[model samples]
Target: MTSDFVDVQIANRWLTSCLSLFGRVFGEDSAHYKRLNEQFPSYPKWPNVEQAYGVLLAAIDDFEKEALFSIKQLIEAEVFDEFLDQAEQLHSSGYFQPAAVVAGSVLEDGLRKLCGQHNVTLPDRPKLDWMNSELAKVGAYNKLIQKKVTALADIRNNAAHGNWGEFTSEDVTAMIRDIRDFMCRYFA
Candidate 1:
């Protein structure tokens, strides 16, 4: 009976670990995670636990075979692309200030992801300049990129604070282009 109890505890721990990892990597909304989540037993019966373990193993195998790169990175890339596309639309519609703000947001998010990928510690509410500096210190990028990010951040700040005269539509266009390139270089 003692051995059985220990086994159950171990199985539960394994299930919890697998669920956490899958949720973090593929996201909870992913089909792989959802399927395994469905297989997890509420009661922790031996057979149910075994079945869930099997499902977890199979999900890992599927993920390994299907994803050549990090799924998180791929997902981030897709999201950034969509946002950049929206920024482009905004620029086309003569809403350059909002476009700059959106493009700046994408840049900031890309920097945060890079910081995570590089294992750089971030504050609770990290600013773009701070993230950029941390990433540079960790050798994620060079001084040139850091300076470019600073300029982009300034433009973003201007747009966010209603400094319309500080930057031009052409500046916003260039900002979006630079952000797209930056994301492709890092997140892609």
Candidate 2:
């Protein structure tokens, strides 16, 4: 709730980001794979990728859940708990999609306010909107942004929903790893 707590919370979340980045690539299952010891020559190889990918998301989920929980606590302390209430009520009341939407929406709101406070104005939001006006900002005339945006859309769907259906363990690993890499190296 205090500035120090906010700083600590943000720093902790950033650490989670780092773990999430690696988890997506290596998987929590990877740890189990490394721990395996073959007892027989014909012992079947362990399956590491799917469970690992699950582990990866599970790690990210921890960081995300904790950060959001801390944020809610902060809001309560600040008496601005309405947003937290809204987030949870929707998330728990059979509005999963809406809950997810509000989470990011609140973040975007804070970003816009921060920009305003600093007298910084741009053509669009940074990460999310970068998919839209990026080409223009870079002085280009192509639809690269659109293509990337489409890829992101697919990635989001695949990462979130296709795990048990269309997405194999390897696919999930590759998807999360690629996304983390793209985010890290994108427009660098």
Candidate 3:
């Protein structure tokens, strides 16, 4: 494999190792579990730590895939041999909104999975409650995590729906930063 591939392999190894640690410490109800998910004890469907670890790991997988393989490279590398023709056709009509939607969905899914895994009671509607409640659990959102997260999702939707008039690379970078910040602050 290429050096980038090697590096990602190493990163995956370390990340998975950390996940094992999460399972050992908070796999079930424990101090970490209570701290992360005890705001509402009545909810019976809280997520377990392994599931949260899965979310984080999946995000890591996403980060790795997107970072390492450009759409063009994916085609040129023949890594998408089966979809090569379709992808090549897409190059003529590439869409940026899908990227934003994917990123937003990753954050949302990861956050919810983490919350449920930790036995946190997450609301079924008016999404972003995890951002609110989880941050409340640790005062991390006091740094305005919710505001940033909401902004990220809003932009993501606009971009996804083609309503975004104009967005710059900086906007995408900021969204990525906020997503990473929240992950680092709470999930990791």
Candidate 4:
């Protein structure tokens, strides 16, 4: 009986770990995560536990064969492109300040994703400059890119804090272009 209890505990632990991994890799909204989540038994036991284990293994195999990393990068690229489009529209409509803010947000998010991809540990609420510095330290990019990101972060901060006169519409235009290129280079 003791051995059976231990087996159940081990199985439950492995299932929980696999669920967490699937959530992180495929996203919580993904079918891979949803399928496993739906199949996991509330009170794991006997054949139910074994079945869940089989499902977990199959999901892992499927994700591995699907080349999920490239798929994830492509998905991110599309989403970032949409945000960039919105920023460009705002700039053309004489809403350059908000445009700068939006572009800056994209840059920050890109940096965060790059950090994750490069295995850089992220803080709960990572600042743009901090992420930039960490990525540079890890040789993810050179100092030049890091400095550019620093400047971009400043523009974003200025826009966010209502410093309208600090930067111009032209600056926002350049910012949008730079962020688009950066996203394409890294995310695409």
Best candidate according to TM-score: 1
Clash pairs detected, candidate 2: 29-52
The per-residue C-alpha lDDT of model 3 at residue 43 equals 27
Which pairs of residues collide in candidate 3? 47-116, 47-117, 48-117
Kindly report which residue pairs in candidate 1 clash with one another: none
Models, CA RMSD each:
6.1, 20.2, 19.5, 6.5
lDDT of each residue in 1-188, candidate 1, tens digit only: 32223366776788788889888777888776787777566556666665676777787687678662677678779999999999999999999999999999999888888888899988999999999999989999999999999999999999999999999999998999999999999887
Candidate 3's residue-wise lDDT over 67-168, tens digit each?
423433333234223232332333235544455555566566655655654566666563755455574475444546666776777877777678767664
lDDT of each: 0.86, 0.41, 0.51, 0.86
Provide the clashing-pair count of each candidate structure: 0, 1, 3, 0
Q: Which stretches of candidate 3 lie over 4 Å from their true place?
A: 1-95, 117-119, 129-140
TM-score of each: 0.69, 0.27, 0.41, 0.69
> How many residue-pair clashes does candidate 1 contain?
0
RMSD (CA, angstroms), candidate 4: 6.5
The superposed Cα distance between candidate 4 and the true structure at residue 131, in angstroms, equals 0.4
Compose the digit string of candidate 4's lDDT tens values, residues 75-155: 889999999999999999999999999999999999999998899999899988899999999999999988888988898
What is the TM-score (0 to 1) of candidate 2? 0.27
